[model samples]
Target: MTVDEVVSRSDLSISSAHEENLRAGPQASRLGVLRRSFQREVHLDAGHVLAERGEAIEKANLVIDGFLLHTLHDGPKRAIVGVSLPGDIVGLSAFGIGSMGHSVVTAGPASVRQLEFPLFEELSARMPSIVLQMASLEAAVQRQWIANCQRLTAPQHIAHLFCEWRHRLARSNGMKQVVRTPFSQTDLGDMCGISAIHANRAVANLRNAGLAEIRRGDLYTSDWTELEKCARFDPSYLRAVRT
Candidate 1:
């Protein structure tokens, strides 16, 4: 499906995420100006490959809506290295790197503002805050990978991801303790380093233990404090502000 198809199927709130981004902060004005410079706004359907590993980095993308998977692909094997949420700039690391480090694939319907490499460099020099914010996002992605790979168990990884998504989506939606996920169990498995069957079991265990619950693609946790403990989660990794 195209972007129009996705919007038609959604809550008819296609511009909700875009509006939120364009009005977010004092920096939004400058960002908006920069965005207006770019002519292409891409709407990707699920399973679309936004970027491939080792491909020449020609442009970067700012996600206005939906999610994407950053995968490290080797032969036929692929492991999800990160997830690009709304407000994320996909392929930012490729700015000076010449080639993409990982493959970026759309997980659901998504819209992105594509910025050419020259324009991206210009923006970095002209708008330092934008650069800083992008750096912060890169740090967050690295931290998440560390947390998922080295710090947390499979179940803990699942809970921690849910918590992170809640915080991220809540930043824009203002809905606490509830996150509408477009990711399926297979996607969750890729993100959490497990099989789909294992991910299902982990979700079941969380539900059975009263730690988290999922209904109709929405995740909810009645007790965040307890869930945090269970997941060994730290919100600091999710912070976008410069330290």
Candidate 2:
């Protein structure tokens, strides 16, 4: 289906939904198997939409390269809800519903390891290990929401988000604290419920405090502690895992 069609279409079949379990987290071996099950590969340029509203998800993606924005749409306007970076999984809602909750579009040039919808359903049912891996991913996404909620304003929300995102990257990469932040001021503004101008001001204030260095579209968090404090951002509030 086309991107424009998603908003108006709703006649998809129920079989599009797949079964899922909470155990999918903290399991490495099962996730590898699940990752390999995907045969189709999607290479998206920046601005390409991965899934649109009401579009039946015949496949979901694992980011092989680049970033994705999970966005909520209202008419021609859009709002970014969450992000998908490397090692992060996207398309979880595709398994629980007939269509996506929002649109998933490439924030940058990206490629995804894509899996067949029916095969994914079968794997989830047959491999108990798959459930564990899925659970792990689901938990991470949950924590993001909790983290954003603690912020008193958009600036704090952005600050908390960066710290949380950095921590997740560290956990996945053997304590390496550096990450190449991909979003722009405008992107952050949308996710944080603020205007682009406000996002830019927040970034400037953060930089003046020696907390981060945003050059071009890349943001470098030199002192995460300071940034967190300046944002009044707290991590204890954002632990997406149910456990």
Candidate 3:
């Protein structure tokens, strides 16, 4: 649905964690001004390409729902460099840059409000704090990506990935213990830098140890504390980026 449609429905609200930050902070009134400047909204189906590597980004998309996969392509091989959840902006780097280094694709059905690059540039110039916030978010995401590629065991890597998602979802949607993940084993492997077979084995290990289990697109943890221990997860980084 469109942003106009979303705004008209009393039951629906802009549920972006980033937008929530904009609302809760001193710049809350500024958010309304920014929303008024929105050009339109775009809806995407699974596997739809939102932005392509090396292509100029004309607009920045504010994710309203679902997930996006950021991928790096090398010859015929591709790696998932990041995953964008609701409340994240997809092309914020395009503020001054000509093109993006990686491609953004829909991981599932999703919707995003479009803001033209020129308008974003103008708005950001008037509000320097937004730029600072975006930079902090980029840094946080990069740090998490580096941590994911660290020398952790297969299960530890996979478990940590799930734990991160769990925390992210909770922050964005008030999601509790259960996480509704729409990723496949192959997708999970790509995100964790493991093979599909290895990912399967790691997931099984998590389940057998009573840590967590991914069943029918949902991740359930018997004990969140125990699961965090297995993953060596520190949620402080996630908290630090929030307003």
Q: Compare the candidates by TM-score and give the number of the best one.
A: 3
Model 2 CA deviation exceeding 4 Å by range: 1-26, 132-143, 146-150, 171-178, 229-243
The TM-score of predicted model 3 comes to 0.85
Query: Which residue pairs come into collision in candidate 3?
Result: none
Give the candidate order by descending TM-score. 3, 1, 2
Candidate 1 wrongly placed segments (more than 4 Å): 1-39, 215-217, 240-243
> Per-residue lDDT tens digits of candidate 1, residues 186-224?
778877778889988888888999988866556788898
Per-candidate TM-scores read 0.80, 0.76, 0.85
Cα lDDT of model 2 by residue, 135-228, tens digit? 5656656566655655356666766667766665554454344556668888888888778999898878767767776666555776767777
- Pairing residues by index, what is the TM-score of model 1? 0.80
C-alpha RMSD by candidate, in order? 6.8, 9.2, 4.8
lDDT of 2 at 26: 44
lDDT of each: 0.73, 0.65, 0.75
lDDT of 1 at 188: 81
Q: Candidate 2 at residue 61, lDDT? A: 77
The positional error of residue 176 in candidate 3, measured at the CA in angstroms, is: 1.6
Model 3, 19-126: lDDT tens digits are 664567756544444544454778899999998999998887878889899999778667898888876777866556779878999988998988767666666676
Model number with the top lDDT: 3
